[model samples]
Target: MGLYDIIFYLFAIITIASAVVVVNSKNIVHAAFSMLLTFFGVSGIYVLLGADFLAVVQIMVYVGGILILLLFGVMLTNKIVSVDIRSGSIQVIPAIIALGAFAAILFSIMTSTNWKSESFEIPTTTSVELGNLLMSQYVLIFELLAILLLVAMIGAASIARRDKE
Candidate 1:
Protein backbone atom coordinates (compact mmCIF):
# COMPACT_ATOMS: atom_id res chain seq x y z
CA MET A 1 0.00 0.00 0.00
CA GLY A 2 2.88 2.37 0.81
CA LEU A 3 6.23 3.02 -0.93
CA TYR A 4 8.18 1.79 2.11
CA ASP A 5 6.17 -1.40 2.29
CA ILE A 6 6.68 -1.97 -1.44
CA ILE A 7 10.44 -1.51 -1.14
CA PHE A 8 10.59 -3.80 1.89
CA TYR A 9 8.68 -6.50 0.05
CA LEU A 10 10.92 -6.08 -2.97
CA PHE A 11 14.06 -6.56 -0.88
CA ALA A 12 12.51 -9.49 0.98
CA ILE A 13 11.61 -11.19 -2.28
CA ILE A 14 15.08 -10.64 -3.70
CA THR A 15 16.68 -12.04 -0.55
CA ILE A 16 14.47 -15.13 -0.50
CA ALA A 17 14.90 -15.82 -4.24
CA SER A 18 18.65 -15.39 -4.08
CA ALA A 19 18.86 -17.61 -1.00
CA VAL A 20 16.97 -20.33 -2.85
CA VAL A 21 19.35 -20.00 -5.79
CA VAL A 22 22.31 -20.23 -3.44
CA VAL A 23 20.94 -23.41 -1.92
CA ASN A 24 19.83 -25.12 -5.13
CA SER A 25 22.53 -24.14 -7.60
CA LYS A 26 24.72 -27.00 -8.69
CA ASN A 27 27.65 -24.83 -9.55
CA ILE A 28 29.57 -23.59 -6.55
CA VAL A 29 30.50 -20.37 -8.33
CA HIS A 30 26.90 -19.54 -9.15
CA ALA A 31 25.85 -20.26 -5.60
CA ALA A 32 28.53 -17.92 -4.29
CA PHE A 33 27.36 -15.15 -6.61
CA SER A 34 23.76 -15.70 -5.59
CA MET A 35 24.90 -15.41 -1.97
CA LEU A 36 26.31 -12.01 -2.89
CA LEU A 37 22.87 -10.90 -4.08
CA THR A 38 21.34 -12.28 -0.90
CA PHE A 39 23.76 -10.22 1.16
CA PHE A 40 22.89 -7.09 -0.82
CA GLY A 41 19.20 -7.66 -0.30
CA VAL A 42 19.70 -8.09 3.44
CA SER A 43 21.68 -4.86 3.49
CA GLY A 44 18.86 -3.10 1.68
CA ILE A 45 16.44 -4.33 4.33
CA TYR A 46 18.79 -3.06 7.05
CA VAL A 47 18.76 0.36 5.40
CA LEU A 48 14.95 0.32 5.31
CA LEU A 49 14.89 -0.55 9.00
CA GLY A 50 17.00 2.58 9.71
CA ALA A 51 19.98 0.55 10.83
CA ASP A 52 22.55 2.33 8.69
CA PHE A 53 25.50 0.92 10.59
CA LEU A 54 24.32 -2.65 10.14
CA ALA A 55 23.57 -2.03 6.47
CA VAL A 56 27.10 -0.77 5.86
CA VAL A 57 28.57 -3.64 7.84
CA GLN A 58 26.47 -6.12 5.92
CA ILE A 59 27.81 -4.78 2.63
CA MET A 60 31.37 -4.19 3.78
CA VAL A 61 31.96 -7.32 5.86
CA TYR A 62 29.70 -9.82 4.12
CA VAL A 63 29.54 -8.68 0.47
CA GLY A 64 32.95 -7.05 0.24
CA GLY A 65 35.17 -9.19 2.46
CA ILE A 66 33.58 -12.60 2.95
CA LEU A 67 32.06 -12.99 -0.52
CA ILE A 68 35.24 -11.89 -2.26
CA LEU A 69 37.24 -14.29 -0.14
CA LEU A 70 34.86 -17.12 -0.96
CA LEU A 71 34.95 -16.33 -4.69
CA PHE A 72 38.76 -16.19 -4.63
CA GLY A 73 38.98 -19.48 -2.80
CA VAL A 74 36.60 -21.11 -5.26
CA MET A 75 38.45 -19.67 -8.28
CA LEU A 76 41.93 -20.50 -7.01
CA THR A 77 41.11 -24.11 -6.15
CA ASN A 78 42.33 -26.76 -8.59
CA LYS A 79 39.91 -28.82 -10.69
CA ILE A 80 36.87 -26.97 -9.30
CA VAL A 81 35.56 -26.27 -12.77
CA SER A 82 35.23 -29.99 -13.47
CA VAL A 83 33.63 -30.83 -10.14
CA ASP A 84 29.91 -31.75 -10.08
CA ILE A 85 28.98 -29.94 -6.88
CA ARG A 86 25.36 -31.02 -6.96
CA SER A 87 23.95 -31.47 -3.48
CA GLY A 88 21.41 -34.25 -3.15
CA SER A 89 18.09 -33.50 -1.51
CA ILE A 90 18.08 -36.35 0.93
CA GLN A 91 15.95 -34.55 3.54
CA VAL A 92 13.40 -32.91 1.28
CA ILE A 93 10.34 -34.27 3.08
CA PRO A 94 11.66 -33.52 6.52
CA ALA A 95 12.81 -30.10 5.41
CA ILE A 96 9.40 -29.29 3.99
CA ILE A 97 7.73 -30.42 7.18
CA ALA A 98 10.03 -28.25 9.23
CA LEU A 99 9.42 -25.31 6.93
CA GLY A 100 5.67 -25.71 7.31
CA ALA A 101 5.96 -25.88 11.07
CA PHE A 102 8.11 -22.77 11.17
CA ALA A 103 5.72 -20.89 8.91
CA ALA A 104 2.81 -21.85 11.12
CA ILE A 105 4.65 -20.63 14.19
CA LEU A 106 5.47 -17.31 12.55
CA PHE A 107 1.90 -16.88 11.34
CA SER A 108 0.52 -17.58 14.79
CA ILE A 109 2.93 -15.06 16.35
CA MET A 110 2.03 -12.39 13.85
CA THR A 111 -1.66 -12.90 14.34
CA SER A 112 -1.54 -13.09 18.13
CA THR A 113 0.63 -10.05 18.73
CA ASN A 114 -1.08 -6.72 19.33
CA TRP A 115 0.88 -4.45 17.05
CA LYS A 116 1.21 -0.79 17.93
CA SER A 117 2.47 2.02 15.73
CA GLU A 118 4.76 4.51 17.43
CA SER A 119 6.45 7.56 15.93
CA PHE A 120 10.03 8.12 17.05
CA GLU A 121 13.08 9.77 15.52
CA ILE A 122 15.72 7.39 14.33
CA PRO A 123 19.27 8.71 14.39
CA THR A 124 20.64 9.70 11.02
CA THR A 125 24.18 8.63 11.90
CA THR A 126 25.27 6.23 14.63
CA SER A 127 28.88 5.93 13.59
CA VAL A 128 30.03 9.03 15.47
CA GLU A 129 28.47 7.91 18.76
CA LEU A 130 29.65 4.36 18.20
CA GLY A 131 33.17 5.59 17.51
CA ASN A 132 33.17 7.70 20.65
CA LEU A 133 31.95 4.79 22.74
CA LEU A 134 34.54 2.45 21.31
CA MET A 135 37.29 4.96 21.87
CA SER A 136 36.28 5.95 25.36
CA GLN A 137 34.29 3.16 26.99
CA TYR A 138 35.36 0.05 25.11
CA VAL A 139 38.84 1.05 24.05
CA LEU A 140 40.55 -1.80 25.85
CA ILE A 141 38.28 -4.42 24.39
CA PHE A 142 38.64 -3.01 20.92
CA GLU A 143 42.43 -2.95 21.18
CA LEU A 144 42.44 -6.53 22.42
CA LEU A 145 40.31 -7.62 19.49
CA ALA A 146 42.70 -5.89 17.10
CA ILE A 147 45.62 -7.68 18.69
CA LEU A 148 43.83 -11.02 18.44
CA LEU A 149 43.13 -10.55 14.73
CA LEU A 150 46.74 -9.53 14.14
CA VAL A 151 47.94 -12.64 15.91
CA ALA A 152 45.63 -14.81 13.86
CA MET A 153 46.85 -13.24 10.64
CA ILE A 154 50.46 -13.76 11.63
CA GLY A 155 49.78 -17.39 12.53
CA ALA A 156 48.08 -18.03 9.20
CA ALA A 157 50.96 -16.42 7.29
CA SER A 158 53.49 -18.51 9.17
CA ILE A 159 51.57 -21.71 8.49
CA ALA A 160 51.36 -20.90 4.79
CA ARG A 161 55.04 -20.10 4.62
CA ARG A 162 55.94 -23.36 6.37
CA ASP A 163 53.73 -25.30 3.97
CA LYS A 164 55.64 -23.83 1.03
CA GLU A 165 59.03 -24.89 2.40
Candidate 2:
Protein backbone atom coordinates (compact mmCIF):
# COMPACT_ATOMS: atom_id res chain seq x y z
CA MET A 1 0.00 0.00 0.00
CA GLY A 2 2.75 2.43 1.05
CA LEU A 3 6.04 3.26 -0.72
CA TYR A 4 8.20 1.58 1.90
CA ASP A 5 6.02 -1.54 1.80
CA ILE A 6 6.25 -1.65 -1.99
CA ILE A 7 10.02 -1.22 -1.93
CA PHE A 8 10.38 -3.91 0.75
CA TYR A 9 8.29 -6.36 -1.27
CA LEU A 10 10.26 -5.56 -4.42
CA PHE A 11 13.59 -6.24 -2.76
CA ALA A 12 12.24 -9.38 -1.06
CA ILE A 13 11.01 -10.70 -4.41
CA ILE A 14 14.39 -10.02 -6.06
CA THR A 15 16.26 -11.76 -3.25
CA ILE A 16 14.00 -14.82 -3.27
CA ALA A 17 13.95 -15.10 -7.06
CA SER A 18 17.73 -14.87 -7.34
CA ALA A 19 18.12 -17.43 -4.55
CA VAL A 20 15.85 -19.79 -6.48
CA VAL A 21 17.95 -19.24 -9.60
CA VAL A 22 21.11 -19.94 -7.63
CA VAL A 23 19.67 -23.23 -6.42
CA ASN A 24 18.25 -24.39 -9.72
CA SER A 25 21.00 -23.37 -12.17
CA LYS A 26 23.27 -26.19 -13.33
CA ASN A 27 26.04 -23.91 -14.48
CA ILE A 28 28.25 -22.97 -11.55
CA VAL A 29 29.08 -19.58 -13.08
CA HIS A 30 25.40 -18.71 -13.54
CA ALA A 31 24.64 -19.76 -9.98
CA ALA A 32 27.51 -17.60 -8.72
CA PHE A 33 26.21 -14.63 -10.72
CA SER A 34 22.70 -15.18 -9.33
CA MET A 35 24.20 -15.14 -5.86
CA LEU A 36 25.48 -11.64 -6.61
CA LEU A 37 21.93 -10.45 -7.34
CA THR A 38 20.73 -12.14 -4.18
CA PHE A 39 23.42 -10.39 -2.18
CA PHE A 40 22.54 -7.05 -3.78
CA GLY A 41 18.86 -7.56 -2.91
CA VAL A 42 19.82 -8.40 0.67
CA SER A 43 21.94 -5.25 0.81
CA GLY A 44 18.96 -3.23 -0.40
CA ILE A 45 16.80 -4.75 2.34
CA TYR A 46 19.46 -3.90 4.89
CA VAL A 47 19.49 -0.32 3.69
CA LEU A 48 15.68 -0.19 4.00
CA LEU A 49 16.04 -1.44 7.57
CA GLY A 50 18.43 1.44 8.31
CA ALA A 51 21.44 -0.86 8.57
CA ASP A 52 23.74 0.95 6.15
CA PHE A 53 26.86 -0.60 7.60
CA LEU A 54 25.48 -4.10 7.17
CA ALA A 55 24.45 -3.26 3.59
CA VAL A 56 27.95 -2.02 2.74
CA VAL A 57 29.58 -5.01 4.38
CA GLN A 58 27.23 -7.40 2.61
CA ILE A 59 28.15 -5.90 -0.76
CA MET A 60 31.87 -5.71 0.01
CA VAL A 61 32.35 -9.11 1.63
CA TYR A 62 29.81 -11.25 -0.21
CA VAL A 63 29.48 -9.68 -3.68
CA GLY A 64 32.93 -8.13 -4.03
CA GLY A 65 35.08 -10.69 -2.20
CA ILE A 66 33.45 -14.13 -1.86
CA LEU A 67 31.42 -14.16 -5.07
CA ILE A 68 34.38 -12.92 -7.12
CA LEU A 69 36.63 -15.58 -5.58
CA LEU A 70 34.02 -18.29 -6.20
CA LEU A 71 33.60 -17.18 -9.83
CA PHE A 72 37.36 -17.21 -10.35
CA GLY A 73 37.65 -20.65 -8.80
CA VAL A 74 34.93 -22.01 -11.07
CA MET A 75 36.40 -20.36 -14.19
CA LEU A 76 39.95 -21.47 -13.44
CA THR A 77 39.06 -25.14 -12.97
CA ASN A 78 39.77 -27.29 -16.08
CA LYS A 79 36.74 -29.03 -17.63
CA ILE A 80 34.58 -27.91 -14.70
CA VAL A 81 32.54 -25.53 -16.83
CA SER A 82 31.33 -28.30 -19.13
CA VAL A 83 30.34 -30.60 -16.30
CA ASP A 84 26.60 -31.17 -15.95
CA ILE A 85 25.29 -30.73 -12.41
CA ARG A 86 22.74 -33.42 -11.70
CA SER A 87 20.39 -33.02 -8.75
CA GLY A 88 18.57 -36.08 -7.43
CA SER A 89 14.93 -36.15 -6.38
CA ILE A 90 14.96 -39.43 -4.54
CA GLN A 91 13.26 -37.99 -1.44
CA VAL A 92 10.32 -36.39 -3.22
CA ILE A 93 7.60 -37.84 -1.00
CA PRO A 94 9.38 -37.04 2.25
CA ALA A 95 10.24 -33.55 1.02
CA ILE A 96 6.62 -32.81 0.12
CA ILE A 97 5.37 -34.06 3.48
CA ALA A 98 8.00 -32.02 5.32
CA LEU A 99 7.17 -28.91 3.30
CA GLY A 100 3.44 -29.30 3.97
CA ALA A 101 4.03 -29.63 7.69
CA PHE A 102 6.33 -26.62 7.70
CA ALA A 103 3.76 -24.57 5.84
CA ALA A 104 1.06 -25.49 8.31
CA ILE A 105 3.27 -24.56 11.26
CA LEU A 106 4.32 -21.28 9.66
CA PHE A 107 0.71 -20.37 8.89
CA SER A 108 -0.32 -21.04 12.46
CA ILE A 109 2.59 -18.99 13.83
CA MET A 110 1.79 -16.04 11.59
CA THR A 111 -1.87 -16.05 12.55
CA SER A 112 -1.39 -16.50 16.30
CA THR A 113 1.45 -14.09 16.93
CA ASN A 114 0.75 -10.66 18.46
CA TRP A 115 2.84 -8.42 16.24
CA LYS A 116 4.31 -5.10 17.26
CA SER A 117 3.43 -2.12 15.03
CA GLU A 118 6.00 0.62 15.34
CA SER A 119 8.07 2.96 13.19
CA PHE A 120 11.86 3.10 13.54
CA GLU A 121 13.88 6.26 13.01
CA ILE A 122 16.72 5.92 10.54
CA PRO A 123 20.12 6.66 11.99
CA THR A 124 22.38 8.99 10.03
CA THR A 125 25.77 7.72 11.22
CA THR A 126 25.20 4.02 11.87
CA SER A 127 28.74 3.05 10.83
CA VAL A 128 30.37 4.77 13.79
CA GLU A 129 28.15 3.12 16.40
CA LEU A 130 28.28 -0.25 14.66
CA GLY A 131 32.07 -0.04 14.49
CA ASN A 132 32.31 0.75 18.21
CA LEU A 133 30.05 -2.16 19.13
CA LEU A 134 31.90 -4.59 16.87
CA MET A 135 35.24 -3.57 18.33
CA SER A 136 34.08 -3.58 21.94
CA GLN A 137 31.47 -6.32 22.16
CA TYR A 138 31.60 -8.61 19.13
CA VAL A 139 35.34 -8.51 18.48
CA LEU A 140 35.84 -12.18 19.32
CA ILE A 141 33.14 -13.34 16.92
CA PHE A 142 34.45 -11.00 14.24
CA GLU A 143 38.01 -12.26 14.63
CA LEU A 144 36.82 -15.87 14.61
CA LEU A 145 34.95 -15.30 11.33
CA ALA A 146 38.13 -13.95 9.78
CA ILE A 147 40.09 -16.96 11.00
CA LEU A 148 37.42 -19.36 9.71
CA LEU A 149 37.46 -17.69 6.28
CA LEU A 150 41.25 -17.95 6.16
CA VAL A 151 41.13 -21.68 7.00
CA ALA A 152 38.44 -22.31 4.38
CA MET A 153 40.41 -20.46 1.70
CA ILE A 154 43.55 -22.39 2.52
CA GLY A 155 41.66 -25.65 2.35
CA ALA A 156 40.13 -24.72 -1.01
CA ALA A 157 43.54 -23.75 -2.39
CA SER A 158 45.06 -27.02 -1.21
CA ILE A 159 42.25 -29.05 -2.77
CA ALA A 160 42.58 -27.18 -6.06
CA ARG A 161 46.33 -27.68 -6.09
CA ARG A 162 45.94 -31.41 -5.42
CA ASP A 163 43.43 -31.72 -8.21
CA LYS A 164 45.72 -29.89 -10.63
CA GLU A 165 48.74 -32.03 -9.84
* Highest TM-score against the true fold, candidate: 1
Worst 10 residues of 1 by lDDT: 78-87
Report how far off residue 119 is in candidate 1 (Å): 5.4
Q: Candidate 1 lDDT, tens digit per residue, 41-129?
A: 99999899888998999999998888998888777663676676544557778988999999999999999999997967888987887
For candidate 2, which ten residues in a row score worst on lDDT? 80-89
For candidate 2, write residues 1-165 as lDDT tens digits.
Answer: 999999999999999999988876766778888999999999999999999889999999998898988877776663666575333346768987998899999999999998996987777869988889889999999999999989999998787675534
lDDT of 1: 0.88
In candidate 2, which residue pairs clash?
none
The parts of candidate 1 lying over 4 Å away from their true place are: 78-89, 106-119, 158-165
Each prediction's whole-model lDDT (CA): 0.88, 0.86
Which portions of model 2 miss their true places by more than 4 Å?
A: 76-97, 115-119, 146-165
